[model samples]
Target: MSKQELPIIDASGPGTACCAPLACKPLSETEAAELAPLFKAIADPVRLRLLSLIACHEGGETCVCDLTAAFDLTPPTISHHLKVLKQAGLIDSERRGTWVYYWINPEVLTRMSALISPASPAPTGTA
Candidate 1:
């Protein structure tokens, strides 16, 4: 990959199409590689549910304590899932004193939504 190509997740530099809906256009190899990790991060059932929980939480954020109760998995396992989300830029976190809080990165979610959503068909002339 050239200098312009970088992983979309967490990449703040130029040439990162973080907002371009996939349905609107086909992905280049660089774009595909960049987005694959983000998809993989949420591929797990637990991780997907965890993301939904956080995204749907009141005030757009949730505490680690609050999240642990929602699943049978241990705290460490949950934390690991959160870590993957964070790494993929699907979510962000902040430590509030003793508790850690997580919130969805709406931009990323919007991008994802746009990606899967079907775009309007282009106009064409017919005989």
Candidate 2:
């Protein structure tokens, strides 16, 4: 009988797609496709700034009217960007009586932070 048998053939070991070495765990193809549009939505500086403002606001949310005033673009232009954020699942909007309110999706932000987090600090030259 071979020393190595069914246990050796298990794919659920360390550094595997099914197990340990957490970062090495592969993202499914479908997940990558779904995340592409979300990253694309955040690629623009304007969108990032807008999101920051809304996220940092006193109420943790902002009305569309208040949001437009801070931008040089027309209200419709701001609305368009907000719409993209909404579609990307990075934000959510609610109609409060008349005006609409927008807020950040903290879960999405957390995932993005994890995705872009540096693996290690750069080495110091003169140590």
Candidate 3:
């Protein structure tokens, strides 16, 4: 199968948060459409854990073999979860020798975090 290029979020660029914080402003239809798939991809319990494992792995990357051992499901099931994370642009993978190595895409995570992060509190006036 051909490798798919994951979406890259430019967190450092101006107005690159993908959307304003959830409580700060309502999302435009286009923004919601673009962001919903990412949330959907990670909504599954297996995929959520898979994402956490990859992000927390030492050196920020891990092989498919390592991930499989953490779950009671078969390797294929783990692979499927990885694929969902990959397709959501949450994680990236590369085939190294006999195993596929995966790592989190930090920019996407940053954008997601920024979107959901609480807005800063208003400053209080001193009497």
Candidate 4:
């Protein structure tokens, strides 16, 4: 099969940073629709591991060659997973000579973390 370049969403779009935590407020229709694909992209076991590997790689980025070594799958299979991540905006990549280097998009990770983070505890003592 041929390699395909999927459209990348701008994770910095409106409402991404302003939304309340999941425990504090239900996701608005737009928010859910926007985020579902991202979550889905990471839902796959291989992709999730690939995301974690890229996030934890030294220097905050790694080459496709390194990623392929971590799994038993073929390079093309690994590339497919990486492509899915890139499509979801959870990761970004650049071609360097014969290799592609990948890195986590920190802003998107921060937004995702904030969305799932628990709300602060209520004050124990009333004013």
Candidate 5:
């Protein structure tokens, strides 16, 4: 159950992989069931685009109105997608007067990035 148990490729290390290859063992049914919804949320293109749009925005956040304009979808459609992102812990929201603003959660991002790849560097002999 350690992070090394996952498959991870780190470009930072001359194409070195930092974690163990996936197990020959299949995921337990409970584990697969647990992971299903989180991946399903990201499987939608609109949600991924919304995440990218917000991520690319300066200050790492954007008003819901600002997000609505980027697509040719109804407000409710956008709201549904944002809801999925929120549920997945990919974004956080705050209300300011009439608008809802969302920003990426750095902590969650860091956790995900590390899950994708693990990197550990120790100072070598006081260098």
Candidate 6:
């Protein structure tokens, strides 16, 4: 399907019923379809590590050289993985002179986290 065909999630938009935690209720078909690519992007070990490395880096960004050093794979392989994460909207990059740097799109991660995170449960007994 074309990118436009998938449901769009607006994190900053007014809240909707769909914002409720996944464990609290089932996802609508649109929600599921919209999120599947994000899940798929992080399903691979390399991409997950790349996410962590970029997200946790100092100054909120990391150079491609830094990311490549942590993996045993060739630069092309790492680049391909980074491309997937970029396409999934998990990360953003910019070219500066000779090098490219990447940073996590915090809003996207926050939204994803909020979607999967459970709400606080009621007290089981009197506090």
Best by lDDT: 6
Model 3, runs deviating above 4 Å: 1-19, 121-127
Which regions of candidate 2 fall more than 4 Å away from where they truly are? 1-28, 120-127
True-vs-predicted CA distance for residue 58, candidate 1, Å? 0.9
Provide the global lDDT of candidate 4 against the true structure. 0.74
In the range 1-127, model 5's lDDT, one tens digit per residue, is 1111212221223322434112323546665564456557678989989988999999878999999999999999999999887877778898989998999765544434443332342333323
lDDT of 6 by residue, 1-127 (tens): 1222222444443243444367767777977888878889899999999999998998999999999999999999999999888888888888999999999887666667667656532333413
lDDT (Cα, tens digit) per residue for candidate 1, span 5-75: 22353434223334335654577787788778768988999999999999889899999998999999999
Worst 10 residues of 6 by lDDT: 1-10
Compute each candidate's TM-score over C-alphas.
0.75, 0.70, 0.78, 0.75, 0.67, 0.78
After the best TM-score superposition of candidate 1, give how far the Cα of residue 63 lies from its true spot, in angstroms.
0.9
Over 4 Å off in model 1, which ranges? 1-25, 121-127
Error of 3 at 29 (Å): 1.2
Winner by TM-score between candidate 6 and candidate 1: 6
lDDT of 3 by residue, 17-109 (tens): 333457666776766777788889889988888888988999999989889999999988888888888878788888988878999988777
**Alpha-carbon local distance difference test for all models:** 0.74, 0.67, 0.74, 0.74, 0.66, 0.78
Over 1-127, each residue of candidate 4 has an lDDT whose tens digit, in order, gives: 3333323233444244433357766777776777777778888999989989999999999999888999999989998988888877788888888978999987666666656655532333422
lDDT rank, highest first? Answer: 6, 3, 1, 4, 2, 5
Of candidates 6 and 1, the better by lDDT: 6
For residue 86, give model 4's deviation from the true position in Å. Answer: 0.5
Model 3, residue 85: what's the lDDT?
83
- Every model: Cα RMSD to truth: 6.8, 12.4, 4.5, 5.5, 8.2, 4.6
lDDT for model 2, please.
0.67
C-alpha root-mean-square deviation, candidate 3: 4.5
lDDT of the structure predicted as candidate 5: 0.66
Task: Judging by lDDT, tell me the better candidate of 2 and 4.
Answer: 4
